[model samples]
Structure formats: C-alpha cells, structure tokens
Target: MSIRAVDLFCGAGGLTYGLQEAGIDVRAGFDIESECRHPYTENNSDVDFVEGDLSDDVSNAEIEEYLSAGEDDYTLIAGCAPCQPYSTMSNGNKNRTEDHEKWGLMDEFAEIVADIQPDLVTMENVPQVQKHDPYDDFCRRLAEAGYHISDRVVDCPNYGVPQQRKRMVLLASKHGRIELQDPTHDPDEVTVESEFSKHNFCELEAGETSDDDFLHNARGLSDTNKKRIRHSQPGGTWKDWPEELLLKCHKKDSGRKYIAPYGRMEWNKPAPTITTQFYNYGSGRFGHPEEDRAISVREGATLQTFPSDYSFVQSEEELSVKSVGKLIGNAVPVRLAEAIGQSLIQHIRNEDPQTQLQTV
Candidate 1:
C-alpha cells in the first residue's frame, strides 16, 4: 500500500519536500495561485500540483478523483488554509472578509474527509488560528466523523528550525489515535549556539545562498540601519547606542523602549521570531550578529532550517533576492515540515525515525 497525501495551499513546496523526504507519496498539491506551480512541480516531480480555489466551488467529487480507486491507499488529506485573518500582525481586520477562511475552509476540509474518508489528516497554520472557534469546530466535526483528532500549538525551533516561530498543528487519523510530536529542542535547555554549531557552516559565507532557499535571506539593511548595526553588539540593545544615533521616536515617551527593536541577533540563543519582514532588521532583532548587512537570503533560510543542500529552483535571471527572501521567510521551514511529516507518519504507524536510524 502507498502512503498518500494532498498538500493544500502549497506554497513553493516546503511541506511537500519534507513529506516526500519521509517516504510519503504526496499525490498532488492544490492551490489558488498559479505561481506555486512552477517551483512546486519543478522540484517535486514525484508529486502533482493542482491549481484551484479550494475555498470556493471546489467539490467533494474534485477531491475524490485523486484518492485511491480500490486498494488500501492509506489516504491523507492535509491543508493549511490562508491564515492572514488570524495573524495578530495583519495590517487590518482582513480576516473578517468572506470567501476565505471566513467561508470555513477548515469545515470544507472536514466535509472532504467525511466524504472520501481518508485514513489520516493534518493541518499547519499560524499559532493565532488556534484561538478561533472555527479550528475547534473543525476538530469536533472530525471526531464526529470517526477520526482520532489531535491539535496543538508548537514552536518551530523545537523541531530544529533555527528561528523562533510558533505554529498550530493538528493530526487526525481513522487508523488509530492521533498525537502531535514532542519538542525536539528545549528553550531553557537549548540555546541558539547549540542548534547550528555542529553543522559545517565555516565554509559558508556570512551572507550567501544555500541550495535550500529557506535557510537565511534577510534583505540587505539600508545604509542607515547598516551603520547602526556596524556599531551594535550581539545580545545588546539600543541602550548600548550613543546619543547621536537615537531615533526621535525613542526620545519620545511613547517609544517602545524595548531591546528587540533595531537589535542584533545573539549567536548563543534561538533567533527572534521570523516575521514577514524579517529581512529588514528594523522589523525586530533581525540584524546580523557580526556583519554590517541585515540577514542574507541564505542566513534567513538557515534560520528557517531548510537544509543547506536543499534546492530552490529559480531561473538565472529570476534570483531577485528580495522575492525569494520573502518566500523563504514566509515559508514553513522544510525541516519543521519534515518533523511534522515524520511525527504524523510515526503516530499513524509507530514509525519513529530515531529508532529506525539506530537499526540501520
């Protein structure tokens, strides 16, 4: 029997890569946009990429056409619906709009599961999404459908991604009970230095591209921020700055007077959260530890924990570091995806990689 999955809202194949690496035969990806097709299909030849508006007019018949015809296909349906609504940082109350998450994509997923009756199911999304009623309702619907559902919020670094990112993850299965993976790394117990020191990063330049696009890709800081970072120390905050460099906003009482703003990353600790504008040091403590520039495309990718050798295919003329940088920073780190995939695979079948590696 083949292990099968369908990645919904697949963005540039991050989760697709991880699941494939773990021997899951992801059949095809469904997305609303056409851009995702190129990188997703090009890199993941073993999988198909289907483009469509999954939240609208998409039907159970459309989803069933891809599932097993007769044999025990061990079907898995998975998606991370567009989560702009739940993010605390979204520009406005965009989550209020209809036809997106508002139309209940999770409910749509549940409806599909009930119809096709896949053996396993999963979803990954921003941590804020867990606070919404829809997520709880979706889980309830899954339980009513005779599936063992498990859900929880997780910190990405715990799964070996270098950045500090939290996510909501859920796994449901008809095969048996479902469970989320345990933390791979501890915060109080695991420092940032301990995460990447073992890897052979010495040959890697301070700012360079990795085969895997998600490693590190902070935008080059502006000249002004560059000058500021040149003087900034790792693990230190704005107080360390001289009076000449203080922004007028900080001089005002309303300024956030916090160390994270315009701060450099400390090598000994996990990176601050990887935000959409993570490339810009001004957004948070995203400045490079020893260099004058902001985090490079590769460094940000590293912070995301995509393996150094993982390939992100782009045309020669298309390496606009900025565009790819956003893709990587905004992407689910492939390793985090790997951990999720591996966890789900093990949970569904008692197939722990650690134990398998020991035997091999």
Candidate 2:
C-alpha cells in the first residue's frame, strides 16, 4: 500500500507538492489562510484544502472529517508550525507574552498526533527552535508516546535548494527509527548562477525577464535606487555605496554591523535566505547580481525549489509582490521536502507489518 500524507500549516503547498513529486499520495492540506486554497488545490488537483485557525484546538472529528480523505493506507501527518515566534529574526518581539499563541500551535500539533496515532509524523522549523523549552518538550512527549524519532538541523543547499536556508527537521515513526536523506549535492554544485542557467535565465537588466517567461520579470526600481544598484558590486555590501547614496543609518556605528540589507547577491554563491520582502532591494541581500533591481518573484520561487509552473497568483490584479514574496519565502524548500518524503517511503517499505502493529 502507498503512504498517504496531510500537511498542516500548508502554506502554498510547498511540502505537499514535494511529497507528491516523491510519489507519496498527499490527499489534503490544512491551513489557517484562505489564500492557500487556490494554489494548494490548483497544483495538487486531487488534494482537498481545509482552512482554520491552528492556534485553537483541532479536534479528532475535525481532523478525520477534513484531513482524512484516504483509506486504510499507512498515514503520515506533516507540519511546519509557524516559526516567527521562535525565529531569531523576530527576536525584537520576544517580550510580547500575548503573541505566544503561535508557539502554542506546535503543542496542538503534538496533541493531534497523540489522538490520531498516525503511522508517521514530520515537522520542519527554524534551527533556533531547538534552544527553547517547547521543542525539547515536544520531543520528550513524542518519545514517551512510543514513537522512534530522529531530528537534525540541516543546511538547505545540501538538499539541493539554491539558497542558504538552515532548518531543523523531525522524522518520527511508530513502526521504526527514521532519518532524513543525506545531502544530494554540495553547496558549490547548486550556486545561484548554475541554477538560474539551468532554467534559461541569463543576465538581465532592470525589470527584464527571459523572453520566454514573464514571471521572471523583476520589480522595477526607482531612479535613485537604480543608480544605487548600478554602483553596487556582486557580493558587495553597503560600504561600497557612494557617500551621497548611502543611508544615514549606514553611517552610524550600530548600523555598520548590519550590512545585509541593501547588499547585492553573488552569482557564484547561494542566495541569502529568501524572506517575505525579498522583492525589495532594501530587504536583506536581495539585489540582483548585476541587474539594477531586486530578485523577481519567480526567481525567489525557483530558489525555494518550486517548479516553474507552480502558480502564486491568478491575475495581475491579484499580484502584489509583497504578498507573493511572503508565500514563497515562508515555504519549506520543495527539494528538501522531497528528500524527507523519499526517506519516509524507504523506512515504511523496510518495516515489517507485524512488528509495526505492536507499537499501536
């Protein structure tokens, strides 16, 4: 029998699409955002989408009704709970006790697994999560529940993602111990220049995309910013900026430490981790290697390992660059997810049904 899966917090179906690519039967996806419905359904036509708040309790009835669309196959429940609360990037808001609701969602995910007793479970999140109490508690609870688990923090470039994103992945099974797939490619093998060339994207100027693809078109820059980028060198920081073009903040002692913003990406290196505002040159090291504009939406998606045809918007009216950037940046890289799926399949195939049933 084929393994079947459901993705919780399934933003734009990155994990779902990837598991499907690895031959897992992904029957449904659940997320709080309604915007996810179209992209998740459109890309995986056979998959159902359920929208609801993950911060609240997800009852057994709701899980069975909305997510359990498959039959008596080996079941997998996968989720990447929102990482913003645990992310170092959002540490400024660390004191906000009320907003910790997002962190509580992971406990809810654990509760669901305890109730449903799925054959397998998986979770992906920022590496910083391991330092906190919640992550440690989740692991302890799962171990106590009789699940054999393995987890490690991994660099995305090792898994064939063309960006320098590091994440912690957990793979647990009631049947037996399982671990994620090893690196398929070294960091140098999947550099930005090499990956772009593979997809037919050559050197581009301001606001230009390949003639064959409009999605590759970059966000246009203002005259001042265009001049700033022209002076910026690939892999260079804000110090390279002319005195007049430099921001007053960059002149301050504290600001000199923060050079990632308004920096240009190197063609020969993996891109800096793609973020929700990646289309804006002012956000992190998102500037094009040589072009006088930020990386395009399609470029961000490609770096996230999303396929060429993965649709983010339906029409021009719906195409807000910031909104699309958030969806792509927040996704688990598709290639990394595929590697996890393949490992899970191997683990399941190796298990003896008689021994697996004893865990339940």
Candidate 3:
C-alpha cells in the first residue's frame, strides 16, 4: 500500500509535486482559491480536492470524514498557512494584525490534528512563525497528544532548488522521533550559470516555456531604466548607471543602505531573494543580467525553481502568469519538499522495513 497524505492550503500543487516525486501518495488538497482548482485537479487527479476556507464548513467536515473512514495508518496531513503577516514586502495597505493573522490558524490546524490524531503530521511556513505564540502553542499541544515533533528552518537552495529561501518546517509522528532530511547539495552553493544555463537545461523561448528552461520574457525596458541596466554589469552597483539615470531614492543618504536591489545580479553567485512581484524591476534586484527589460513572469518562476510548464492559468495573458509566478515565488521550493519527504520516508522505513518509498 502507498503512504497517503493531504496537502492543506495547497496553491498550484508545487508542494504536491515534490511529495509525489519523493514517492508519498498525496491523496487530497484543501484550498479556498478558484484558480488552484483547475491546475491542481488536472495535475493531481489521483488526489481528491476540497475547495474553501481551511476552517470553513466543507474543509473541516471533509477532513473529519477521511479520518473517520475505514482506513487507519494511511493519513498524513500537511499545511502551510498564509505568510503575509511575516512577509517583509507587503504594500502596507492591509491591517497587519487584523487581516494577516494566520499565525492563529496553526491553532485550527492543531485542533484538527487533535481530533483526527492522524499517524503523521507536517507543516511548512515562513521562519517567522516560530517567533509567534500560536506555533509554540501548537507544538506544545501536538506533543501532549503523543506526536513527537521536530521543527527546523531550512535553507532551500542547499537542497538543489537553485534559489535562496528559508522556511520553517515541521514533521511529527505518533510512532518514534523524526528528523529532517540532510542536504543534497553543499552549502557552498552553485552559480547562476550552473542553475539556469541553456547548455544542459532546456530553452525558455518567448510565449512558451518549461519550468526547467532558462525562462526570460524579454520585455522592452523604459528608456531610463534601460540605460541603467545596460551599464549595470554583473556584481556591480548603481554607480554603474550613468549619473543621469540615478533615482531620487538612490540619491538619498539612506539609499546607500539599499544598494543590493539597485545592482545587477552576480553571475557567479545566487540571486537575491525572489519576491512575488519580481517582474517589476523596482520590486527587487530582478533586472536582467544584460538585457534592458526586467525579467518576465517566466524568468521570475525560474528563480522560484518552477519547471517551465507548471501552468498558472491567468486571464490578462501577461499578468495571469504573475499570479502563478507569485504562487511559485511564495512556495516552499519543490526540492525542499522532496528533502522533507525523504526524511519522513527514512523515519517510516526505520520503523517498518516493509514500507517502501519508490524513490529514495
């Protein structure tokens, strides 16, 4: 029999893909977004899906129903709550305390775990979740319920994702103690050319792309920003841009502290942290290495470690990709998920040699 699991707050199934790749049978997903339903269901047909709020009538009821069903030792529940409250780059429009309180949602997750008492429990979130009260409470409660919990903040690129993102992850089980997976790649890391080169990888041509392709959209840059990027060679700062193109923000004394974003990406180093709005050159250090245009949505997804065809399904044709890219940008990279899956598989195998993970 396969190891069965559920993915909560599942976006476009990036985490699901990784779990599946690591040989766990993800049986279902729960999310409130409509866009997720199409690609998620299409990509993950073997798994049933529940649409709506994680705490709403349908999601909770369906969870209970599955736990109460005839099967036992076949349940694995994983969740990732909203990270907006912990995000460093919000627009400052939403009420932080009121609108983005998903730290408390861990309570809801704990409640379901307490009720269902599934054999395995897991969650992934931003590193900031550890500082909040709710996660601490949730961990305490899960331990009391006899689930041994192991938590850590892992750097994703170290596991072969090619991006630098850190996330807090948890793995718990009713059996014995569990540990996280070890790194597949060294912390020293690979270079940009190593990650996105067209030599071994596929091409990311215009209007079409694969997640593994070196994706770039090649949009026309504004005349001024264009000149700025043209002179902004690898590893150089805004000083590379002619004096005429310097922004007022760069002119301020305080701006000196923010030079990381105004410069070109270093050819020999990992790129800066990729954000959801990475297509906007102003959002982060997302300018092309040599091209005048800011990165296209495809380019942003590459930074997120998404394979070219992980479809986002949008209406604006151009902006539609942004939604998918944002989700990809915000995702726990599939490679990281695969590492987590590998650790959990080892834990299970240590207990029961009969349990098989198709992939190690």
Candidate 4:
C-alpha cells in the first residue's frame, strides 16, 4: 500500500529525496539534462535516473517500466516543469516569444498524467506560473479527468525551510479530497539565532572555516569586494555601501529599487530565495552574514534544505561553481517536498486504513 513515485523533471533528486524521507518509494527520476545523472543516482541509490527531454515524446512504456517496477498498489506522478517561460521575471521582455518552446512542457506533463492516470498527481512551480494560461489548461484537464484537486501558492518558510521562497503546489487525487497541511512554522518563528547559533562560530569571517569538514568551504571574494562586504552589515542592502564604493548602476534610478545584490543575509532571519547565480556576490543577497564572500556551495545546499553531505558535484573536474549553483538553486526545497510527501501519506492513510504501504 506504500505509494510508488516517478519524478518527472527531477533536477538533483530533491523531491525524490524528500519523498524517500517521508516513506514513499521513489523508484526513478526523469530529466533532460545529462548532468543530473550522476547527482541523482549518487544521492538516491536504487532510484533509476532517465535522461531525456520531457518536451519531446516520452513513451508510456518508458514511464511504466519504472513505475511498475515496484509491487505497490498506489502510484504517484510528480512533475515540476521548467518555469522560466511562465516566470514573472520574463513578463515584460519582448523576446518572451523565444521561450515559447519551453512553455509546452507543462502540456507535456499534463498529457502524461492523462495517459497514465496514476492514483495521485502533484506538481510544484514558481508562483507566477499560477496566472498563466497553460496552468489553467492543466487544471481544467485534471478536472475533466475526475481528479479531486487542491492547490495554492505556499511560502517555503512556513514549511520549515530557512529561506523566503514562494512556490505554487498542486495536489490531485482520484481516491479522495486532499490538500497540503497547514504551516508548520510561524512566519515570526524562523530567526538567525535558530539557524546559525548552533555552530558557535556564528560570525564567519571571509574564507574562514568552522573546522567542520562539510562546511569548510565558501566562494572566495575579490580584494575589492572583500573590502565592500566589510562595510556591509547583516540584513543591510548594498545602499549601505560606502559612497566611494558605489557602482555605476547604483547611481541610476532603475537600479535603486534592486538592492539585494551585494547585500548580507541577517543571521536571525530566513535567507532570501536562493537562485542559480547565488555563488556570485553580485547576484541577489548571497553574501554570508559575517563573511566577505558569497555563500559557499555547502551553504547554498544547506539553505535549500539539502543534507550536509548531499553530493552535487561528484568529481574534481566536474566541480564548477555555476553548474552546482543551478542544481542547488533550482532544486525543490527538501523540507517543503517532505511536507508534501507527508500530506500525501496522511491522505492515503485517511482514505484507506486497511491499505498500508510496504516500506523499503
């Protein structure tokens, strides 16, 4: 009676990892990028990683082979199609049409769900995607397929993730009504003290190590940027920079409203949404609270709710800041996904007390 799951568009197995953590049997992950193969397989052993573009035709035989591999009575199909096309960040750009090719991926996901008709279905994406026509079409299709659907934009911090991120989550069940559970943490509850005070080395200086092998690394800073962060305070924006260090863009009216870049995260609060360029101090508020450099790969993974030892870059030659940054930032926060998995578990148990999932 345990649910068997196949993750579509699974990046670095964040959702798969969380599902496994929540007692679901995640059998495989499907992704287009060849880079995901190593990390996905390495982190979640025994789960097959299928590398193929979802936008193209993904045959039912391929998905069924993985899903049916397990002897479970219930099945779950989860996908978080690429959200860049429907992102508000791309809203006003004239070249938005250029991303039209990617928008069809949602439709592709819908098509698969309709064809498979799994016992349960779930999807997570940027909140902005909620307003798009494709999402509406997807929901309508699910309704037509007789799904009991529930969905809402969820704040990540509410689910115990120590980051300010908002994502739209959708849950649909053919068995019964199900919705995500209420918030586990109050908005005012997550503080710098709660997240950082445990280590004793709360104030990490640039290139400083807490002597913990896993957290011993961070992105190094240039000498000039190092001096800039020295002037930057916790939770303070780039505007706090000394007048002598002002960049050319900062003087412009358009750039004044964008203050997160080069800003330092406050220790007592949830970090800002981690992004693909998070390794660069110039991108968003990535600077370590007391350090002169941007957060390290380990710190980025930590903020994303990845376990301390979760491997993103496997080999020394494959270790590039940009590639690993994308994998971490684009990951479904593990804590949030665990909450979703817990909800599904509860829903299944409520609907059928006699049916118990087999544990791996």
Show pairs that collide, candidate 3.
Answer: 210-308, 211-307, 211-308, 211-309, 212-308
Better of 1 and 4 by lDDT: 4
State the local distance difference test value for candidate 1: 0.69
Model 2 TM? 0.92
Candidate 1 C-alpha lDDT tens digits along 1-360: 556778877877788877877777787888776667776887675777788777575666777677754464567787777677667765255645433443467666667777878888888888877777777788888888888878888877677766667888888888677687787766654444665565554333334444544344344445566567777999788777777887888778878465687888888778887765667777788777766656665556666765655455455355655556556666667777877777766774574323322100
Worst 10 residues of 3 by lDDT: 198-207
Instruction: Name the regions of candidate 4 deviating beyond 4 angstroms.
Output: 69-72, 196-216
Each model's lDDT: 0.69, 0.82, 0.70, 0.82
TM-score of each: 0.83, 0.92, 0.87, 0.93
For candidate 2, give the lDDT of residue 85.
Answer: 84
RMSD of 3: 3.5
Model 2: CA > 4 A from native:
55-58, 65-72, 202-214, 353-360
Q: Could you give candidate 2's per-residue lDDT for residues 172-281 as a string of tens digits?
A: 99987788877888878888887777676656676675666656778777888887888888988878878999888888997888888878999899999988888888
What lDDT tens digits, residue by residue, belong to model 3 across residues 1-360?
A: 446778888887777777877887787887777767765777654877678877765555677565443343456788787777665554245466446656566788888888778888888887877876777898999999999899998877688765557788899999799988777887566555556672343332223334443234444456676667777877677877777888888899988667656466665676776777776666667765655556566656666666656666633343464566567666667777778777777788887888644441
> Which candidate should be chosen as best, given TM-score against the real structure?
4
**Residue by residue across 290-357, what tens digits does model 4's lDDT show?**
76778777777877888877887765556776788888888998988988898888888888887766
Candidate 4, run of 10 with poorest lDDT: 195-204
| lDDT of candidate 3 at residue 240, scale 0 to 100 | 76
**Candidate 1 segments whose C-alpha is farther than 4 A from its true place:** 57-59, 91-103, 186-218, 350-360
